[model samples]
Target chain A: MHSIILFAHGARDPEWARPLQRLREAVLARRPEADVRLAFLEFMTPSLPEAIDAAAAVGATDVAVVPVFLAQGGHVRRDVPAMLETACARHPALEIRLQPVLGEAQSVLDAMAEVVLAG
Target chain B: MHSIILFAHGARDPEWARPLQRLREAVLARRPEADVRLAFLEFMTPSLPEAIDAAAAVGATDVAVVPVFLAQGGHVRRDVPAMLETACARHPALEIRLQPVLGEAQSVLDAMAEVVLAG
Candidate 1:
């Protein structure tokens, strides 16, 4: 089975995860059977490695990690890859694909522009 | 004239602002004459106050500050309002409006879901 992990840079405030959670729900809403989960870079539960391990344990043969960040910064560019490498070593059979950050997507940017224009 | 300030949490990596810049360009593409600028919370130029001041100086009677964050963390819930308060005091004549964070918008969330599913 294939799984999708929505990775985000977590904040100290618990409420900070609300949007990330909403995004996961949005994904599941569209594809109810999709195995989607949330993982944080810091200050929250289920770090990248843990999320990957859980996915592997659940018989996920392939996993796509979607960074829920506005841009590709050091965390998205550096830290995430390092964590993925470690996860790969642990689960040699699981194929993990790192998708581009959400903000980098043109559709996401257009949506944001529309929101800004509407406000 | 009204100005739109896209506020983001800047990072040390200069490339971190590219998505934000694209969002600004996207806004301008739809409305060529619209006045839009980017401001950072930290690690970049044109802080929120500076952006607001520049807009006020450019004869913008109103300004819309859009937080390009995925969620309302302390930075958005607290820091931004404090910055806006200071800016309001500095530019009493310029009506400043703080829009909701981009990620909170339903359309943006749906767009993100689409991107996730496409990957």
Candidate 2:
């Protein structure tokens, strides 16, 4: 089975994870067979290593990490990859793919633009 | 006229602002007459206060600041508002409105979920 991790920069506020959790639910609601989870960079539980390692333990052959960050900031560029490197060392057999930053995605940009224009 | 500020957390990489800039352009493309711009929280130019003050100086009676952040983190909940409050004090006549965090918006959540599900 494949596992998709919606990676985000967690904050001190516990409620900050709500939207990401909602996104995971939305993804799962559409594809019940898919295994989607949340992994945080900081100030939250289940860091990237834990999330991916767990997937590896569950016999997930492939894992894709999609950063939900608005831009290619330090967290997305430096911090996430550093954590991913450690996750890789722990699970060399896991086929992990990192997706592009969400903000750069064409659809995301269009959606944000639409919202701004509507106001 | 209505001025929209697509505010975001800045990064060291100058390219990091590309998405927000694109968002501003996309907003303008659909509404040519609308005045949309980008303002950063740190590590970038045109801070929130500067952007709002400029808008107020340009005779803009109404201004909307959209936090392009993914969640209700401290930056969104505390930092942005603090900046807005000072902006309000500086320009009392300017009708400044702050929109909800982007991730909480239904359309944006849907779009992100669609991307996750597509994977």
Candidate 3:
């Protein structure tokens, strides 16, 4: 089975972490066969490298790192990739796919609309 | 004085909320004149409309809704704008500027790098 890592920009309010965790649940609900986990880009515990290590420790040979970010900003373009490079170096046996950052997906946009209207 | 609302994609872990709240604090630390607050896009409390109401209650004539999102997906392009439109309709006196989503900034990328290395 492939292990999936969802990367997010960590928040301080703790409540801010809700959506990302929900998202991880959503992804797991859809793909139960995959080992899904969450990681923070900053300001939270279990950073990406640590999360990746945990996943690897759990015997995940093939891993997909999905950035839960919204844009292709510095995190996506540089930081994420560079992190992957180091993580990959450490886990040479693991097959890693650093997926694209979550941008303006139609479903995500719809979700955002729901938030606006519901609010 | 202008009020600023930082809208985030809420997380379930609460820890996810940290970065955005910290960002708000950072903004407030620099711009004390601005009333900085936070609202979640989903799975959290004090949605955008309610947050706006709170800001309006605090007597902010001009409000800037800065999306803590990353791309121009449906949320940035459509949902957020629609929310602002409704909010504007309710508060005709409020001048709301829907700022662009945070994306691919060199600084943000740098921040991401810091997260990776530090981890």
Candidate 4:
């Protein structure tokens, strides 16, 4: 099975995860069978490694990690890769693919632009 | 004239602002006559107050500040309002309006979900 992890930089406010949860739901709404989960870098539960382990435990052969950050800052560029390297070593058999930060995507940018224009 | 400010949490990496720049360009592309600018919370030029001041100087009777953050955490809920309050005091006649964070918008969430599923 293939799993998708929506990784985000967590904040102290419990409400911060609401949109991420909604994003996960939005994805699941389209593909109900897809195994999608949320993981955080800090100030929240289920760090990247933990999410990967959970996916591995569930017999996931391939896992795609999508950083839900606005841009590829130090956390996405340096910290994420370092964590992914350790995750790879821990689960040698699991294939983990790191996708670009969501904000960098043109479609996402266009959507945001539309919202801004409408507002 | 009216102005739009795409506000974001800046990072030390200069490249962190690329996507936001693209977002500003995207907004301009749709409305060539519209005035759109970018401001950072930290670690970058054109802080919120500066952007507001620039907008006011440009004869903008009203300005819209859009937070490009993924969620309404302390930064959005507290820091942003505090900053806006000061900006409001600085230009009481500018009629500054604060829009909701981008990630919370359903259209943006759907677009992100599409990107995640495509990856």
Top-DockQ structure, candidate number: 4
Every model's Cα RMSD, please? 0.7, 1.4, 13.0, 0.7
Compute DockQ for each candidate against the true complex.
0.94, 0.77, 0.06, 0.96
The lDDT leader among the candidates is 4
Which pairs in model 2 have colliding backbones?
A: none
Tell me each candidate's TM-score: 0.98, 0.95, 0.53, 0.99
Q: What digit string (tens of lDDT, one per residue) describes model 4 on residues B38-85?
A: 999999989999999999998999999999999999988988899999
For model 2, the stretches where C-alpha displacement exceeds 4 angstroms are none
lDDT of candidate 3 over B1-119, digit per residue (tens):
58888887775555556566656655755556668788988777789999899999989998878787753445556678888889999999998887655542333333333222222
Q: Alpha-carbon error at B40 in model 2, in Å?
A: 1.1
Give a tens-digit lDDT track for model 3, residues A48-73.
99999999999998888878765445
Q: TM for chain B in all models?
A: 0.98, 0.94, 0.88, 0.97
lDDT of 1 at A22: 90
Which lDDT values do the candidates have, in the order given? 0.94, 0.86, 0.69, 0.95
DockQ of candidate 3 is 0.06
Better of 2 and 3 by lDDT: 2
Q: Which stretches of candidate 1 lie over 4 Å from their true place?
A: none
Model 4 has a DockQ score of 0.96
